[model samples]
Target chain A: MFAQSLVGAAAAVAAHLETLLAEHQALPVVEAMGYATRGGKALRGYLVLESARLHGVPEGHAIWPACAIEAVHAYSLVHDDLPCMDDDDLRRGLPTVHRKWDEATAVLAGDALQALGFELVSDPRCHPSGEVRADLALSLARAAGARGMVMGQALDMAAEATDVPLDLAQITALQAGKTGALIRWSAEAGARLAEVDPAPLTAYADRLGLAFQIADDILDVEGDAAMMGKAVGKDAGRGKATFVSLLGLDTAKLRARQLVDEACDALSPYADRAENLRAAARFVISRSN
Target chain B: MFAQSLVGAAAAVAAHLETLLAEHQALPVVEAMGYATRGGKALRGYLVLESARLHGVPEGHAIWPACAIEAVHAYSLVHDDLPCMDDDDLRRGLPTVHRKWDEATAVLAGDALQALGFELVSDPRCHPSGEVRADLALSLARAAGARGMVMGQALDMAAEATDVPLDLAQITALQAGKTGALIRWSAEAGARLAEVDPAPLTAYADRLGLAFQIADDILDVEGDAAMMGKAVGKDAGRGKATFVSLLGLDTAKLRARQLVDEACDALSPYADRAENLRAAARFVISRSN
Candidate 1:
């Protein structure tokens, strides 16, 4: 049921965003960007729509911010896969942006998409107050830029030293930056779009983001590349620091469950529309990819 | 006198933006960003102030946005110099951000500074309205992101083969991505912050950015490495396309003058405040570094 709901909500988001990102001006780039963006787990969007649902946010209100989140998330992936960055050539069973276009095009596409993400959040139709839109813009900017993703990547770059053996706290910080930061912000941004109190669920997102990372670590060990369309055991092969390495597989699996419970607990206060979000957290831990 | 004003204005920008950037939650990262940011020549800031002066914008009105523009420009340089990108270890006569802090920290600082630049623009303290600031933020975001500097870097990377003699238009587009686009937007954004007609002066900036590239091409042939603080003649050595290579040094110099003159002509309607901007056009050709 939760899996089906995630698909339903994500489809809703894609359907809504398709018109906004329709081909024009630089249509090829936009079309390429759309191709790169679709086929994500839609976990972040699910959390957003779920939170909106729990809070009784009117349908269609949260779509813009949800699309904005996905854009940023996808753009980050494109740049992150560059030869200089994560260097991955495959994502979600498709050629990475750099592989699809030249490296320059991928880099440019990612950069444009990042700016496009900010532009979307500030769309006059979605965010009424330029001030508030700017605020949201600021949030996405910081979360995706150096203070967040770039820093996490830098840490990942130097992680092979083994001296940087990350403890639980350090691991969590990286996760917060690498994956959780965006996820948490997606929910918060969606809530803020409706002018709702995000403080009520910010912690929920924190817990959920870490949960996502832990689950990812588990999947790397257990999943198949053909099925997952992502390199299996990449974390281990890279000698990168991960919770499973730091905590052992049993501990990491248990920790993921603990985080899932905390994430659900945080959402309990906003149970109405948040039901989807709550179920999404449970699904995060169990998904194959 | 113009040179003196430019230097003094840059110093002033460095001082004012310090306070704004200091308010970040991560102070070390913030200070490192400051280090990466503080040393700019303030040419872009001068354009903003001078452009505003052309329109008779009040002197006090220029400080915040002027500082903001410089901050944004500095942040772009900091990120651009990373090992994954330009890989330069030096900037503005000082060690680059990645050198000062670890790479991760450097990336974070750059990201934070970029976010901060937009945040400053959004606040009424810098510009008047959310509507205007949103546009301001959008303009900066579009020009600086992957499609702009990052894309340009990727192009440079792709062009690193033994030979790829680009035609004049391709060279222009490459330079536009690398050096021209941001400069063009810088002047436009400065005008936008002043709440004036940026279109007229943008022509000047377009010419100026192109002129700046032509001048850079000329310098590569004639410049001393000690003075340039960057590799000199590396373009030719690498067989990269450049104005000097495409049009020859003498023609490149002539094109630069024509561009500068055209830039000046674009500002004919408002001659008084355009003095520094005009001086900047001259500076682009004349500066040793």
Candidate 2:
């Protein structure tokens, strides 16, 4: 049931994005932006919609933040896949933006997409109240900015430059900023929109984000390249310390399961209304890709 | 007088940015961001502050938007000078971000700075009213996104791929979106802050933006490369059409002068109170570097 709901949410978000972006003049960067954002599982978008559903926020208002998170996610991927970063040629089973177009177009497309994310959340259409819009924009900016994803990326780069591999604690801190920050924001977005205290959602999201990263590490070890849509074993090859490397693969999997359970437990206050969110936590650990 | 005031504004904005960015972990990307934003003329920031002064908005409240625009401008320059973009090696008499740091650091730094810009404008410290913060974020995003700077950049790249050089009108449209968009936004910021009609400021900005581009074109033709801190003659060498090439040097200079006069005329509602703005208009045309 949760899987079906997630699929529907992803579809709705994609349609909204298409309509929103259709007005952009048919320039190459605009086209590249569309390409970059297309065909994701839209996990972040689903988190937003599910959390909103749990809070009784309508899909209409929730979709803006949903699309906004997805756009920011897409932009991060585009920049991360550039030659100077991950140097990945493939993403979502197709050429990355920098590979499909040129690096300049890739860079500009990513930059514009990031701007569009903020635009969507801050627009009056996103919410009737300006306070909500301001809150959403402010939180999204913090989650994606220096103290968040960018900081994680910088640390990752710095780790690559260093002779000593990162310890488990250091890697956790890096991942928290890089991937966890955005995940936390997506999970808490519904509560923000509904003007409810986000303590429960924040607690749920914090554990879920950690579980998600550990699952990623597990995927890097055991997943098929075709299913993952990119090369696996990159973490081991780069000699970067990941959860699997530090804790051992079996231990990493056990930790992820424990975190998933904790994440679900944190959502118990909402009872069955958060069933989808609970399922999402379990799915993170079990996902093949 | 305007030049001195601009210098002071730049310094103040720089100091504010330092305080905001100090919390960032000591990573290469953070360092590159600092380098990218340092020591510019801060024309956009000056516009924000000057326009705010004209509207009787306090400098304390106005400084946030001023710093925000400057941060966005710095991000654009960093990305524009990348090896895949203009491939310039110098900026503001210093090495470009990508040249000073690696391309990955440059890309992440630019992305972070853009986020910082939005974060600064949307933060409550910028204004107590959430409505004002939302409005500023929305407008800035639109002005800096695909419909604005990115659109201009994509057009520029596409024009390079074509056999035909862009005509005068086409180039003007391109530059208007590329450089003029931010200038217009900077000028209108004060009106937005004051919640006043921006017609006069908008009119003043439109003409001023055109004159500023024309002046840049003139600089490419005749300015000292060392003083400009970047290569000159690249436009002519690339066989790109510019104002000087299309209208001839003398005609281009005359057109810039006419635009400056009109920009000043648009500010007549404020009379002598807008003298600094008028001086800024003339300075755009006459500045050596």
Candidate 3:
């Protein structure tokens, strides 16, 4: 049931993004924008839709932010794959945007995607209350800007440049900003949309995000490239410090399971109504990709 | 009087941006963000502040959007100057961001600056009304997204790759998106903040933006590299289609003057209260850089 819901949310978000992209002029960058956004797991969008469902928010209103987060995620991936960054030629088993197009197109497409993300959330169609829309845009900017994802990316790059590997606490802080911030924002979005205190969801997301990263590290170590749809064992190859490297594979697995349990427990305030969210927590640790 | 106001607006916006950037972690990307934002004419920011003043909006509230537009402008310039793009080495008499830092830092800095733009406009402190803030963010996204500045940039790049030069109408349309969208947005922002119709200011900006581009073309043809603080005569050397190239230098100058007159005429609704704006339109054509 949870898997089906996740698939449904992905399809919905993809369709909505298609509609938005269709409204744009037929430029190559626009085409690249659409191309880059395709084939992601859409986990962030799923979190948004599921959390909104848990909060009784309508699918119509929630879909905008779902698409918004997906756009942001796609943009980060596109830029991350640039030759100057990760220098990856492939993502999700296909050529990255910079490989298919050029660096300029990739950069512009990524930029437009980020702008589109802001556009989707702040648009009046997303919510009737402008206050809610403004809050959403502001929070998203915080998640994506200098103090959040970008800072994490910079720190990661800096760490890679040095001979010294990062310690556990340093890695945790970096992961929290790089990936955790967006995940937390996605999970807590419904509460923000509903104008409720997001304390419980925040707690749930904090644990879920860490579990998600640990799972990613584990996948990098043990998962097959075909199953992951991208390069695997890259962290170990680069000698980059990750959960699996720092904690050992067995201990990392144990820690991820514990974190999943803690994440599920944080959803207790919603009782059985949050079973889907609980399933999502388990899925984070179990998924190969 | 116009020069003084423009300089004053630039200083105020710069100081506000400095305060905002000071709050972020001192990452290399964050430092690059500050470097990229400095030394511009701040024309778009000036338009925002002057328009807000015309609409009786306080400086405290207007400064956010002013800085927001500047950030967006800075991001575009940073990305445009990338090695894969315009490959510019100098801007405002100093090394470009990519020259000073690495390409990765430049890309991340530009991305963060764009996010900062949306954050500033949608911030609660920017306005008292949520509706207005949301509107500002939505409009800014439109101006900066695929349909606006990015489209213009893509078209410009496409034009460069082909042997065929764009026709007058095609070039006009391209420039309208490239530089005109943000200028129109800046000019119309005060009315949006005041919750009034932006038709008059939009009219003024359309003409002013066109005139500004023609003047830029003229500068490229006849400018001193030392005074321009960047390359000159490159458009002619590349045989690119431009206002001066298509219309001839004398005709381009004449057209710019006529557009300035039309832009000034559009502000008749404000009568003598719009003297500063009239001065701005003239300055757009008269300035050397």
Candidate 4:
């Protein structure tokens, strides 16, 4: 049921956003943007749908903001692959944008995507009022900009240690910047689409984001490159510390279970409304990628 | 009187947006952000005020949106100065952000400014509805992003030859893209803030933006590099075409007067209400930088 809903949300966003990109941006840039978008696993998007379903958000009504969330996620991936940042040559079995085009074009394309995301998400008709949409857009951007994503990058760059041994809290905070922030944003945006109080959803997101990162660490250690469809063991190679690096593999798995359990407990108040999210948490640790 | 109103709008935006930036983004980034923003003539901010004043928009109601327009204009200048774009070394007499910080930092700073702009512009109490604020915010982003400002840069890059004369229509099209688009968006957003129609003001903006660009071209030809604080003779140096290059100095000044006359004529219906704008058009030709 959760998988079906996830697929539904992703499809709706892809279809609607194609029209948006074509209409609002230049044609060549739009085509390149579409290529960057098609490479994602739709994991973050699925979380949005599953969270909204758990909260009883109408899919049709949620489509607009959902598109925005997906666009932001896509843009992050695109920018993360740039030469000045990650310098990654390939991603998810495709040539990364920096490799496909020059670095400058990729930069402009990614920048446009980020702006486009906020623009789409802030469309007021999707929310209860223009004020609510404005607030949501502010929250989303705050998460993605200097206070959130940029801060995370700056931390990673400024880390004095060659292999920083981050404690659980530090790891969580870093991932919150690197990955968790966007994950939480997607879920929160979904709840906003339903016009629900975001306190419980935020708690759910806090645990969910860490579990996703822990699972990523585990997969990097255990999963084969072919199964991952991207680099495995690349994190360890870079001396980029991970949860598994901080904790032994056995302990890291234990920590993942603990985080997922806490996440499930957070959602228990909603009963079956959160079943798909519970399943998603289980999927996070168990999947190869 | 026009200068005072323009400065009022710019100062109001600078003061309020500083708080928003400090609270959301880090103090350091905001400080650096402040550094980049403090350097402009606040021309965009002035346009918002002049139009607002022309339409009899109350001073209190005018304060919020005018600030929003300035933030957007500041963001465009930051991004446009990126080495990948204009490769501008100085902006408003200070080293460009990309030069002061890393290229990546400049990129993120630009992103932060754009987010900051939307947040300020979309503040709920400032507008009647979330939809209205969203429309205004989106219009600003559309002007700043690929199909508008970015596209203009791309076109300018491809143009290459400064000596080749661009015909009247081509010159107008380029000016509309590079200089006029954002100016036009500013008028429309201010009109929205007043809950007034932007149609009548289109003629005013159409002429206002051209006169602005023509003045810029004239400055490029006759102005001193030390005072302008940017690379001079670039139009002739790189062979990028301009109105003065195509029409020669005499005809270019004549055309500028024609545009200014048409712009003021468009405001004839407003009379004393448009006095500030009439003063602004007169001031444009006399600006040294």
Candidate 5:
């Protein structure tokens, strides 16, 4: 049931993104942007849509923030794949933006996509209230800026300079800013859009984000590169620090299960209305890709 | 006289940016953003503040957009100077961000600064009305996105691949997006803040932006590297087409003068209240660097 809902949310957000980008002139940057945003699972968008549904926010109002998060996520991937960054050639079984076009196009496409994300959230059509739009933009900036995703990227780059691998606590802190920050923001977006207290959802997100990372680490160790659509076991190959490196494989799996349970428990106040969110938590740990 | 006001605006915006960025954790990316935003003319910020003054907007409300434009301008420069891009070593008499830090930090810093620009424009303290903030953010996104600055950058990159230099008309159209879009947006920001018609300032910006590029071309032909803090005559050396190359040095200067006259004439409705803006038009063509 959760899988079906997620797929539906992904399709809706994808269509919305396609339409929004269509309005832009048919420049190479625009073409690269469309190419870059495609083929992702759209998990972030799904989280946003589901959370909004849980709170009874209309789909019309909810789709903007959902597309906004997915745009940001796609941009992060585009930049992260740049040669100066991770230097990856493939993502989702396709050439990365830089590989498909060039480095300049990749950089500009990612930058423009980030701007588009802010534009979507700030559009009046996204919500009737200006305050809500401003709040959404502000929170997004926090999640994606120096205190959030960029911070994690910076730390990751800096870590590559030192021979010493990060300890478990250090890796956790780094991941919290990098991957975990966006996930938490995605989970809490519905509450922000609905103008409700986000504490419950935020609690759920805190656990789910960490669990998601653990699953990613597990996948890196055991998952197939063909299925993942990119290289796997890269951390282990590079002697880089990761959860699986700190904790044994069995122990890491156990921790992810525990985290999923805690994430589900945090959603108890919403009762069965949050069943999809609960299932999402479980899905994070079990997904093959 | 206009130069002094511009200097003062630069100082005020710099101080505000320092304070705003100071709140973030003292990470390398934050430090790079501060470094990137400093030491330029801050002409864009001056345009925002002066335009707001012409429209009788308060300084408190005006500073947010003023700083926002400057931040965006700084981010563009930082990215444009990356090794994969323009590959510059100096800017504003200091090492470029990529030169001072590593390439990764430069990329992350530029990305974060862009987010900071959106954050400032969307903050509630910038305005009481959410609609006003959203409008500012939306307009800014358009100016800075694929349809605007990014579009120009993409064109400029594509132009490099062709053996033939861009013709005058092509170069003009390219400059309109690369530099003119932001200038036009900055000039009209006050009217947006006042929620009044932006026609007069928009007219002024249209001419002023073209004139500013002409002046840059003139400077590239004759200015000292010490004052400009960047290599001059590179366009000529590379045989790249420019206003100076197409129109010749003397003709470019005359054209810039003509544009300044038209830009100042556009401000006739504001009369004495627009003295600073008129001086700005004159200053754009006269400054050596």
Candidate 6:
């Protein structure tokens, strides 16, 4: 049931993005934007939809933020794959944006995608209350900007340039910004939309985000390249310190499981309505990719 | 008087941006964001401030949108200076962001700056009305997104790759998106904040934008590189079709003056209160850089 719901959320978000991008079909950058946004697991979007459902927010109102997060995720991937950044040629089983088109197109497409994310959330159709829309845009900017995702990325790049490996605490801080911030935002979005206190969701997301990163580290060690659709074992190849590197593989897996349990427990306020989110936490550790 | 007010606006905007950025001072990308934003003419910010004054909006409220536009402008310049884009080495008499920092830092800084733009406008402090803040964010996104500035940039890149020179109308449409959209947004911001019709400001800005671009083309042909603070005659060197190229130097200058006159005339509704904006239109054609 969780798997089917996740698929449904992805399809809904993709369709919405398609409609948005279709208005600018003539531009190559727009086409590139469309290309970059396609085919993600849409985990972030699923988090948005499931969380909104728990709060009884209409899907129409929820989908905008769902698509918004996916756009942001797509943008980060496009830019992270650029020659000057990660320089990955393949992503999601296809050539990266820079590989398929050119660096300029990749850069501009990434930029436009980011802008589209803000546009989606702040749009009047996103909610009836202008305050809600404004709040969404503001929080999203904070999550994605220098103090959050970009700061995390900068730290990651800095770490790679040095010989000294990061300890567990440092690595955790970095990943919290890089991956954890957006995931937390996605999980907290429904409560924000409903104008309710987001403490429970925030607690839920913090654990979920840490678990997600740990799972990613484990996948890098054990996952198949064909199944992952991108390069695996890159962390070890770069001599980068990750959860798997600091802790033993067994310890990392044990830690991830603990995080998932904590994440699920935090959702108890919603009781059974959060089953999909609980499943999502389990799936994060179990998925091949 | 006009020059002094413009300088005053720049100082105020810079100080505001500094306060906002100082919170993340430890990050390299945040530092790069500061570097990219410094020393521009702040024409867009001035327009926001001046237009707000005309509409009886508070300077405090106006400054947020002003800083927002400047942030967006900085991000564009940082990305545009990348090796894959214009490959510019110098800007405003200083090394471009990509030249000063690594391409990765430049890219991340630009991304963060773009997020900061939305954050500024959407923050509750920017306006008492949530609808106004949402409107600002939505409009800024549209101006900066695929259908607007990015589309124009893609077109410009496409033009360079092909042997066919863009004709007058095509170049006009291209500039309308490239440089014109942001300018229009900046000029119309105060009216939006005031919740008034932006028709007159839009009219004034449209003519001012065209005149500004024509003047840039004129400067590229006739201006000194040192005075302009960047390379000059590059448009002709690259065989890029510009207003001066298609119309000849004399006609282009004449056309720019004519547009400036129309731009000033469009503000006649405000009478003497718009004298500074009128002078600004003249400055667009007269400035060295």
Query: How would the docking of model 3 be graded?
Result: medium
Better of 2 and 5 by DockQ: 2
Q: Could you give the fnat of all candidates in order? A: 0.27, 0.79, 0.80, 0.30, 0.68, 0.77
- Off-target runs (Cα >4 Å) in candidate 1 are A8-35, A49-61, A82-89, A94-109, A128-132, A151-164, A234-241, A245-251, B16-35, B52-68, B71-113, B128-132, B145-165, B238-240
- Listed in order, the DockQ scores are 0.29, 0.77, 0.76, 0.38, 0.68, 0.74
Model 6 lDDT per residue over B1-289, tens place: 9999999999999999999999884877888999988999999999999999999988988999999999999999999989999888999999988888899999999999999999999987777454435888999999998878887898898898899999999999899989999999999998988889999899999999999999999889888889988888889898899998999988898999999999999998999999999999999999623
Worst 10 residues of 6 chain B by lDDT: B124-133
Give one digit per residue, the lDDT tens place, for model 3 in A1-289.
9989888888999999999999998888999999988888799999998888888988898999999999999999999999999998888888989999999999999999999999998976666354535888999999999888888899999999998999999999999989998999999999988889989899999999999999999999888888877778888999999998899989999999999999999999999999989998999888733
Per-model C-alpha RMSD: 4.3, 1.4, 1.5, 3.4, 1.9, 1.4
Off by over 4 Å in 6: A128-132, B128-132
Off by over 4 Å in 5: A128-132, B128-132
Which scores higher on TM-score, 4 or 5? 5
Q: Least lDDT summed over 10 consecutive residues: which range in candidate 3 chain A?
A: A124-133
Q: Which stretches of candidate 2 lie over 4 Å from their true place?
A: A128-132, B128-132
TM-score on alpha carbons, each prediction: 0.82, 0.98, 0.98, 0.89, 0.96, 0.98
lDDT of 5 by residue, B1-289 (tens): 7777888999999999999888988778889999999998899999999999988887777898889999999999999998888888989989999899988888899999998898888876666353535778888988998888888888888788788899999898889889998999999998988889999999999999999998998888898899889978877778888999999888898889999999999999999899999998898888733
Instruction: Report the number of the highest-DockQ candidate.
Output: 2
lDDT of 4 by residue, A200-239 (tens): 6678788878988888899988988777766678777777
Indicate the fraction of true inter-chain contacts that candidate 6 also forms: 0.77
Per-residue CA lDDT of candidate 6, range A1-289, in tens? Answer: 9989999999999999999888884777888898998988899999988888888888998999999999999999999999899999889999999999999999999999999999999986667454535888999999999988988899999899899999999999999899999999999998888889999899989899999999999999998788888888999888899999999799999999999999999989898989999999899888623
Pick by DockQ: 1 or 5, better one: 5
5 or 6, greater by lDDT: 6
